[model samples]
Target: MMRRQFFLLPLMINALMACLAMALTNITTDQHALLAFKSQLKLDPSHILSKNWSVSFPTGKWIGVTCSPRHQRVSALDVSGMRLSGNLPSQLGNLSFLASLNLSSNSFHGQLPKELAQLHRLRYLDFRLNGLTGDIPFWLGLLVELRFLNLRNNSFTGTIPSSITNMSKLQVLDLSNNPLQGNIPEAVGSLFNFYP
Candidate 1:
């Protein structure tokens, strides 16, 4: 029994090391993605993210960042109304655990990054009051778990995609103040929670 226990100790230690490595890697991915986003910003009027987002600090402790207690991964990022101006970076899609993202009342422009479709865990997304252009990507429908989506007061054109009907869980969808034409999709009537 002593010999068996001795051999098991090494195996247990190796397993613990592997778990720790995985946990670090997960948080590192979130850090790298956020840094990439900050690098692309054209303006940070108050240097909120400029100074706060650094390798020296834990991401969860950063201003406007929220991490899940169980996973220690970034789960929510609300940088609304900081006067930030930039193109949305594709690296944001790397925040695999992100559930709520609010970038409203900023100066961000450019089209929505298609990579964002990877955020299957997203529940609340608000991009209102920006200069974002281009058609709302149909891939947004892939976020089946999304509950609230606010894209009001943008420059997005084209008709609302019928694919949005896939978001059965969606409760609030505000697409007001755009230049979009065409009627709302008939299939959207099935979503009882949708308020348009």
Candidate 2:
């Protein structure tokens, strides 16, 4: 009986280990998404996220990162006002779980990456006060969860995509300072009038 119990103990331990491994895998994927975003964006020069960055266990407490409890997945990335310069990285799209992304008040210049449309969970995106220019990617309308979108004080130009109307959850839309032209989408006026 002692030998039989010993054999069963190993089987149970192996099963438990397998379950733990699966959970860790899911957590790692989430963490990777956040880390990828951090790596893609340009950071400040004060060694803030400059060196010794780790996305696992107790290390994420460094700076410019906010993570969840259990899996340590990043939820918000607020790297605003850092004067950082670089093109918005396409890798940012990997952060599908991000709720808020604030790269405002920086020197970032480039067309908005189309991949950003993949952020289905993003609620607030503030790219105002940057140097971003080009036709606003129509893909942005795909962000169904977005509420506050501030692209003010930038160089974005071209007709406002009618797709902007797809953002049903949007509450605050500030494009006042951009170079966008053309008649405002009628759907937008019907849904929420900005002018009396």
Candidate 3:
């Protein structure tokens, strides 16, 4: 009996360690995503992400990070009013669990990345007051969970993609202040409470 117990103890310990490792990987991936954003986007030298990003603690303690208790990974990133300038990186799409991303009131330029469509869990995306240009990617409609989308005050041009109407859960849609032309697609009315 003593010999059997010893063997079982090691197995249990190994399993516990595996679970802990998996949790740590998730946290690391989430943090890496935020770091990638900081590197790709030109941020104001006066205001920057926390330098102590290696420490583990409540996400609220970290600048621009928000996490949920159920899953200790980052859920939201609000970097508004930071006076940031630069183009977004395509690598941002790697964040599979991001829910809200707010980078408003910055000076970011370049075309909106098609990679952004990969954020399946994203619900709120605000890129307002930037210099982003080009057609709205059709893949954006694939974000079925999206509820709030604001791309206002940008240099975006071209007809709004008809696929945007597929965002059935969307409650607020603000594309005003861009150079977009052409009649608004009829399907846009389908979004429950979408407003200009």
Clashes of each: 0, 0, 0
Which segments of candidate 1 are over 4 A away from where they belong? 1-11
lDDT of 1 by residue, 1-196 (tens): 9999999999999999999999999999999989998999999989989899999999998999999999999999999999999999999999999999999999999999999999999999999999999998899999999999999999999999998999999999999999999998899888968865
Of the candidates shown, which would achieve the greatest lDDT relative to the real structure? 1
Q: Report the Cα lDDT for residue 135, model 2.
A: 89
lDDT winner between 1 and 3, please give it: 1
- What's the TM-score of every candidate structure? 0.93, 0.78, 0.84
Model 3 lDDT tens row, 66-98: 887778767788888878888887767867778
Instruction: Quantify all predictions' global Cα lDDT against the true fold.
Output: 0.94, 0.77, 0.83
Tens digits of per-residue lDDT, candidate 2, 74-172, equal 667788887777787776776656788998998888899888888888999999999999988788889978888889999999988888888887888
In candidate 3, the residue pairs with backbone N, CA or C atoms under 3 Å apart (3 or more residues apart, or in different chains) clash, namely none
By summed lDDT, the worst window of 10 consecutive residues in model 1 runs over 187-196
Candidate 1: lDDT over CA atoms? Answer: 0.94
Query: Can you rank all candidates by lDDT, best first?
Result: 1, 3, 2
User: Of the candidates shown, which would achieve the greatest TM-score relative to the real structure?
Assistant: 1
Find the 10 residues in a row with the least total lDDT in model 2.
187-196
